[model samples]
Target: MVDVGTTLEMVQASQAGMSALGAGLAVGLTGIGAGIAEMAIGSAAVGATAENRDVFGLVLLLTVIPETIVIFGLVVALLLLF
Candidate 1:
C-alpha cells in the first residue's frame, strides 16, 4: 500500500476526502432527525385539525420548525463543497 504521508498532495487529498465524508454524514443524520420530528408534528397537526380548523395556521408554522435544521445542514454542506 502507498504511504498516506508519501507527499503533501496525498495528505491534502486524504483530508479533503475525509471532510466530504463528514459533511455527508452530518447531512444524513440531520435529515433523519428532521424526519422523526416531522412525524410527530404531522400527527399533532392532524389531531389539532380534527378538533379545530382554526389550529391549521398555527399547526402549519409549528410543523415546519424541524425543517430549519435540515436547511442549516444543507447550507453547511454547500459551503463545504464550494
Candidate 2:
C-alpha cells in the first residue's frame, strides 16, 4: 500500500541519516587517531624538552604535527554537512 513518493522520501531520509553518521564517525575516529598520535609525540616532546631547553622549539613542532589529523577530520565533517 506504499506509494512511490513515500518510498522515495524514506530513501532520502535514510541517506541523510547515513551521511550524518558518516560525518560523525569521520570526526570521531580521526580525533581518536590524533589523540593516540599526540600521546606518543607529547611524551617524546616532554622528554626531549626536559633534556635540553634548546630543543623545546623542535619538540613543540613535533607535538603540533598530530593536530593536523583533527583539522582534516573537521574539514571532512564540514564537507559532509554542507
* Predicted structure 2: lDDT: 0.88
lDDT of 1 at 20: 94
TM per candidate:
0.79, 0.82
Please list the residue runs of candidate 1 whose C-alpha ends up more than 4 Å from where it truly belongs after superposition.
1-5
Clashing pairs in 2: none
Model 2: per-residue lDDT, tens digit, 1-82? 4456677778877878888998999899999998899999999899988889999998889988988998899899889888
* Cα lDDT of model 1 by residue, 1-82, tens digit: 3585488888778778877987897689899999999999999899999999999999999998999999888888777767
The C-alpha RMSD of each candidate to the native structure, in angstroms, is 2.5, 3.1
Residue 11 C-alpha lDDT in model 2: 80
